[model samples]
Target chain A: MIERPHHVPERLGLLSGAAADPFLTEDLLRGVQGHGGVDLAKVVEPLPEDDARWAVEPLRDLVDDAMFQFKENRTDADGWLAPRLHATLRLTRREAADKRIWNHIALAVAPDYVAWRHLPTASEGKVPRINPVRFMGAPDRQCFSRLWWAAEMFRNGADYTPVVRACSNQDLIHNSLRVSLVDHRPTAQALVRILERGTATTGREINGLITAINTAGATVIYDAFAEDEPRDPWALRQWITDAESAPPVPRHVLPTGPDEEPVREDSVAKLTEYFADLFETAPVRGRTP
Target chain B: MKFYPYKRLNRPIALRVMSATLKLPDGTFDPLDTSAYSVPQRTVALGVAQHEDWISARIGLSATLPPGATDADAPWSGLRVLAVLTDGDTNLRTTVELRQDAPDSKEWSGQIEVLRDDHAGRASLAAYAVATVDGVEGRSITETDADWTVDVVSEEPLGGLRLDVKQAGFSKSAREWLRPYADVPWVIDTSGRLPLVMINTDVEGFSDLLGGNGGGIENKIHELLLSQMATDVWTAVFHSAVGDLEVEPDGSPVFPTDWRGEVLREMLPDVAPGLHVEEALRRVHRRRTDDTGWVELQTRIHYAAVRRAGASKAVANALRALQQMNREDSE
Candidate 1:
């Protein structure tokens, strides 16, 4: 048996300078080997090997592609990577809610990715460090979990296009996901539509619109107007069941969601109109003049 | 040397009445029932009775005399003499003076002396006097100058329900309600169930439309409210039960009679109802079934369409041309 020596690259700053000396690439590979052959299957719990969704290689490849694609613009990676990651993962909402699985992925399966994606930048003469919460926190706060949940909540049925738009606007995904109301499909869709239409181009505009909508909701009943189709529970069950035999989600094109009915166009139109009306009255700081 | 709660000098006059009776030769001269004598100017009146040279009279006194004054003036002295008048009328007038030595002390005493009286009676007479008191003058007292202090406890409870505006999702509503008294201290408990929905509209211009101040806090609250409203609407549409739909094994409702197809068929009357079923089935064919080997063949066809779309020739070229034309016209 041969023991591999830990190797440190020449550039210390390439990886976060805050990491300890032993926390290098060779050490990470050793950790992966120690945890059973760098297969994410060994790391995640409850999911059996036979489950087609259990394959981690495809996801690792996708992550690599994302890291390569957004090499220059790390912030822009969230919008592009989130929906694709969700589509490729192909898990039921029930499975996605499991924090243990995300914890394992961030800690054991892909700690390097977490480090790469979320290592904080230095400011105010102080060295920046990653918060531990990003690896194992609530769904709305954890690094990968937040992105995955954002993708799930924002995507239209059988359409990941709207999700891309929503995620692209950092404020919309980051702020709206924390709010319980974004759980509504039509509202999520309508919000994305507002962005797509260029009704809200700037971050300030997005913030103002969000504020006005929240305030107006005190008196208005948004549900009374924007009706959505009842989700067929069997469809979701079937979608989850199909995971064992389902093909890999396409890398180049957006993956299809479950065949459940999309939000009604009329309802989305109504909300968009209502929200537009609200934004008109909302007080924007610079626009006060 | 006796001290009362109220000084005798400050106390109003106390009036006392005394009477004596005179006896007449006839047994009918009982002064107890003497209604004959009347005095117009007398402040007090007395009645007398006489029986076999033994006589007595009853006297009544007025309450208008000076404090501590005694009945020793002209009217009272005249009443001591028994002068029978032919006119059969007797009356007396008198004045009483009250004196006090201590002007500043809480403990002070006074005496009253009655004066001036003219009375003429047959055998015995009774006399009475009235008393009066003057007002006391002093400076106003401050709280510090007072000897004793009184503290009153409020018999009422504290003000309104304390609410945690953040948790209750009523921060905005609570703020709005409390806006008029912005400077006043208020206790808000935000633990109560909020009736309002918290929406998060992360879109531009929406918050302004809703009349929110587009500050970060206000915008965040607005987005929360909108999100809640959207969820409510979505839940109502999707989760509500209908009589016609059959519940699937997994608890999803299914249209037992192809009801959805029927509606679509009816809307597009030109398309035969049977053809609508075929179209729906064709759309369904795009989905994969575990038992059906037909999925592979169907996927192949889909792949071919996708490949053609990707390739720079054939159907893809035609579609691209059409899309380009549409874009040009819109521009």
Candidate 2:
């Protein structure tokens, strides 16, 4: 186990691409002796003092547990980490969009977790690496952000159960996140529902479904047939207001989200049934017609 | 008693009072057949008459008039007649006059002054207002007439006219979710009217409306609704009226600061041009639908609460080892 920094800042800060460079040493990439956390701390700009929103400890605890639990199969860390991270972080979408915060988390607070989950193999012909972009990439490409956003889009209403199924397949996040089509709540839920129903099991099958849906989305007005009701803004306001008194998100169980209602069941079912049909005709590579 | 929106009281009514339950006080009930078209009865409906003649016939002959008082004492005249209504506590004195050119046509045109829209604004009034000289029931003032206007003389103290949707028998959330836009004078109707605030908000999360899936539910809605407000204030106020939209002191979205730039771009386009104006409006219409900005900021407080939780386990381990060595030497 690597030692955490003695003086990890109390709140989250912006660790920009330039600021994060020196911290990505070979030892840090390998999850071994690393010493620049104190120096790296200076460059990161602190968030508001009144806000207790940017604490780095729960995240530290979460990653520590994930690392300990998934030591044997490091890639499997994402399944446990994604939901727990989203639950622990409890961030709204705008907060997550700021890449600087993720940079701070990856390089300043828990570079070791980033390195552990994504450290590349040092094969004979290639140099071993953990790309800087993983620490400060787009939401889907960054290590923590990808997991957070995947949990956000995939979760149904307050339920994180769908997110578990979503993160179960690495290809779902890898392939689906890049496309903008997955943003529709019903569409996102339908994709997961199809996966749950065993409609598309393999990576290639899910990929084919995603491709078809994205293509169909441009022409079809999905909302016309499968309607989602208007949500009350007050519920969200109350939820955001309640953040101050919220208890720690339970580790063993998935935490509930803002009480905004789920996508209507019928809408999801309709989209699910529709997507299933789209998937059947979609071209899957290596399949015999 | 929220502002109750409705189908205009006096426009031509196609659907008449239906059912055995709706008989007039005189034991006469006129039910519309499948088409549901009929006028109100004279006893239950308001009649348009010359202001001078109506007051003299009804109020002038009344015992309520003082001794030896001439018709001049009455404030009303041929130019304006008051729709004398009272459900007792609520006194709605609507003074209206017919168009000068069409006085014989019997069509009262001009502003509807709601002196009081209390409980006095009855469901029956909405159905039975604007009847014939024989008190024949008439049409409802549908929004279709671009010229029709309801001028609220003063809604103060009692508050502005609202779509008392619950009172009008619309499905409702436990608590009121929308604020009444009193400035925009709306017609009183017994038919449950949806607030314009809701339809104007593009945040109407239709799946086909397709949001950024990865965005937080709060951010996505705030982004869409705030921009909708900027592009069209009258249209977007529903998002604000709903009580969920948070704006800065300057009235900008608290989250998604750049909301305007993107919102302006999307709304600037004629995004959905194929639909007719009425069709487009119908699509945005909401009836008894609950809205939520309904987002909460769940503070992940365990982070700051466990401030030292990020301190090096190695350093703590080293400190423990030192403590053990000192205790062993003492032993």
Candidate 3:
């Protein structure tokens, strides 16, 4: 694997798509050498010099540790990395929505991590190429972004245990995140619950279940049946405010997210039952009636 | 636009907001102006700064069902009314159940809590009546004909696609990029998060003419000039949006998620009439890349832009003002 950048920025900087495009060369994507940090840093539009939260060393250390720790099993890295990444990189949804920030993270700071994690397994008989979208793409397709959003969407209020569970299932992250229906907290929890209970084990099963839920979502308002507690914006704001002095997320223990109330148990149960029923009738190609 | 197996109310449900209040960060509440709601536009602006310390906004909604809704022999059972607040940007859907006014009352009322964190810009609110029909539970029997736009961030209650307009002295503005475009009265920039119409104040009296809400021929001419600008902006944004779209793994285009998506959704139907927005986008994208039918589609695209800018209406008003002025001079 490629080494960490020689000189990491003190703070995170925005890398516009145009600035980042040239660096996403074919050589870097094929697990080859990427441009060093010195060249990339010259083009980076620096974030506000004053904000402590934009500090890059903490984030660099996190990704470096993530890569080293998960060297044995890369696919497992996502479950470990997602919540920690979110906790470490404190941002409002508006700030997170900016593609440029994520683009910078993937290209300038951690292109090696991108290639290491997403380079396809040697099965297709094609050149093992990493998709450039992983470096600079939509939230769902971009490597770092998908993890951040998965953490955001699946995290039950301040609890990220559900996020870990959701990220564990690759199919859940791959298929479910693209669908807006999973944004509903109860609905997100219910999918995690189904996966935990072994209702849908295979990728195909999970994909079918997600499709069924999304289709049913078009007809029925799932929120009407399984209502979530109205989250306090103050709590989220306070949590973000606390990021400046917050401790680094633990390596072993799962970190707690914002101090907000978790999704109601009854709502999760309601949707779990409803979704399991939907999955049973859903057309899984390999499964027989 | 939606089909259900159950027997539904033929008449549309009438939904209106009865009150709106904002919850502050320090645990106090304040009344939000009722003018923040536009009945004609069917939109309610939750008049609180999203970045401010406000916690949430509670919008009290009243919905009146059609006459047959409360009939004793109605086909459905376990009837319930709900207000669904959906934010496409955040992908959060919140539903609040409404209570009937009396035993067989057609009037239903409830308040939906708008969490500031859950919405980015505009969220949509719609009312639906659901019930068990033919053994299917929680099936939507009827819904509001049009969803009301609940803009969590915007202070104005205007509906439809609204682009940002800013007054900048191009010659001496803080924005360095605008300095190059100083000669022009305005420029349309779609590269940003939203399409911004930068009206250059360097053009003498240009700002007054565009900003003027005065009476007489001046107002008519102002309206005409604004329409012309809008036409140019709409055209530019549409092209910029179509030019830059993400494609799925299967090579099909993925509908954008930002202002590009909104612009496409609003103008695609007009650009490619009778086709769904997604399909229209695909067609337009295919033509642009494949070197076929793109040049021909330019007229339709321009027409859509012109229509959105209300060029015809502006021209008619200008002509009417001229006619009135001619009559006054003769008199």
Candidate 4:
């Protein structure tokens, strides 16, 4: 087990993939060992000092508690960690887009968590290695980016319940997360609604439904059919600001995101009902009529 | 840094599939049970027959002709019976392309198109597309980004006669790749450089498309494409690093002639030395992977109609694609 750094940085910083390489070692790959943040912290180029969002311990403690809570089964920690992480480190898409911050979180803050979540399942392989790509990959594939993006994409405004549901099914996240479609408030919510309804109960079903949704999106103008309210930038700004004095996102229950209006119920219901029908007819390879 | 693994970020659209089946022997079109997408009151089925295609075997969506429907009925009224000509992956295809006209929003609602494939359309099959309606939604026969131009003969009964998109010269990707290369006076360049550029472009695209997905036949084919292009001289030109290439007087690209003469000898030694590249590519037919990456590629190759798609290595892959379709249909 790795200990939390005694010296938590005051602000976040950019940690390039090239810069991240030195910290990843063989023991880290195997989940046998992890390092403290003190040394890794040296490489990061700190963000603006006054930004309250830059605080690191809240983020650090979230992962530490997650590791301890889900010790027997680390992968289960994702559902617990994602929303808290997103709420804990409030930022706009612009801030999140920078790879360095995530690189820092994965390498410096919780390299152990990354390895714990992603370590090889089988002891035997050409080499039991967690891909380096996970350490510094695209926002959707990297260890931390995926969770953050999932929280961003799947969260119903102010409602992390959908995020928890979306995170539960790994395939659900895989098929829908990277697609531009998931970015929509209703599209994201509709998928969760369907999952809750047990329409797409399995990974294969989810994959087929996602593929079908993507295919149909070409012709039909989803926006024209299901209109969304314009986003209030003020709500987002206030949410980020509140992180300064915000209470820790509770673990026992889902947390709320920005206190903005949730997606329209009619629109979600409309897409949900429609998507459910699509899943019925979608081509699942072994499925029968 | 490695790119984040993502599927083609399609604009999410709401689609309602309005589809049915056509029994050829009876010449009757029986509507399959489609999701609840009601047709507009102006028509039972649009007098406009947009697309159509045929396959001997397969179950699922079938096309249908209205009772007593005739060629004389131009824009047939009260005729919901129509045949889906293409983009219907080697099976009975009925593609339902809703209006993806939401320029501002990528998320669409109405009828959701599932299967992500095995459906059909005339000018363009149904897909979640944006930015260029014609470029993306209007192009190609499968769940791909290729465009197809169909002469929807209103008279073609059942709307089923599908024609291949005018051969490769019109392909969008080929246009992008060939536009710059064509302008240069470079000719008689047999250095395998152009092919190398093409191979690299595809490799990069493939990496973006298939990089993160779990292993599948598409990955295998991508690996095969990479290895063959790198090792095989005839094909090596296509896989050469783009930075190192220079144009030839005769328009052939010049690379650092690392041509594996022995590989070419093994495949087609008897062919004239320079002609080997063409033969090697033509030999490469499409083996159907039913992968999004495969569909994207075949559309481009077929569109570019490079040196006659019938002979293009990518087109050769199309042959395998056809075989796969046949297998699916038969199954």
Q: Model 1 captures what fraction of native contacts?
A: 0.00
**3 or 4: which has the higher TM-score?**
3
Off by over 4 Å in 2: A1-3, A25-33, A122-124, B1-331
Error of 1 at B311 (Å): 75
Q: Which of 1 and 3 is the better model by lDDT?
A: 3
What is the Cα root-mean-square deviation between model 3 and the actual structure? 4.9
Which candidate should be chosen as best, given lDDT against the real structure? 3
RMSD to native, candidate 2: 28.0
Task: Give the total clashing residue pairs for model 4.
Answer: 73
Model number with the top DockQ: 3
| Local accuracy of candidate 2 as per-residue lDDT tens digits, A162-190 | 88888888878776766545555677788
Q: After superposition, how far is residue A36 of candidate 2 from its true place, in Å?
A: 2.8
Q: Put down candidate 4 lDDT per residue, B1-331, tens digits, no spaces.
A: 2131222223222222344233322344434332211323111121123223321111222222222222233322211211122321111123332331243332233331222122222222333232222232222111223222221222222221112211122123322323334332111112221222232233234444334454544644554443343333233222222223232223343222222222333333222234454443333221222233444444433332223222345435645766787788899
The worst-scoring run of ten residues by lDDT in candidate 4 chain B lies at B161-170
Writing each residue's lDDT as its tens digit, candidate 2 over B1-331 gives 1121322222332221221112232434333122211222211211222111111011110011121111333222222211222121111112222232242332333222222112222211221122111221221122111111111121211212233311211112111112132222121221111122233122234322333444334434434433332233322323222222222222332221122212222221222235543332222222112252122111211221122222244335545666776788899
Q: Could you estimate the TM-score for every candidate?
A: 0.41, 0.47, 0.83, 0.50
DockQ, per model, reads 0.01, 0.01, 0.34, 0.01
C-alpha RMSD (angstroms) for model 1 = 46.5
Query: Tens digit of lDDT per residue, candidate 3, span A149-196?
Result: 899889987788888888888988877766676868888899999999
Best by TM-score: 3
DockQ of 2: 0.01
| Comparison by TM-score, 1 against 4, better one | 4
Model 3 off-target regions past 4 Å? A1-7, A13-51, A119-132, A285-289, B48-52, B166-192, B197-229, B240-258, B276-292, B310-331
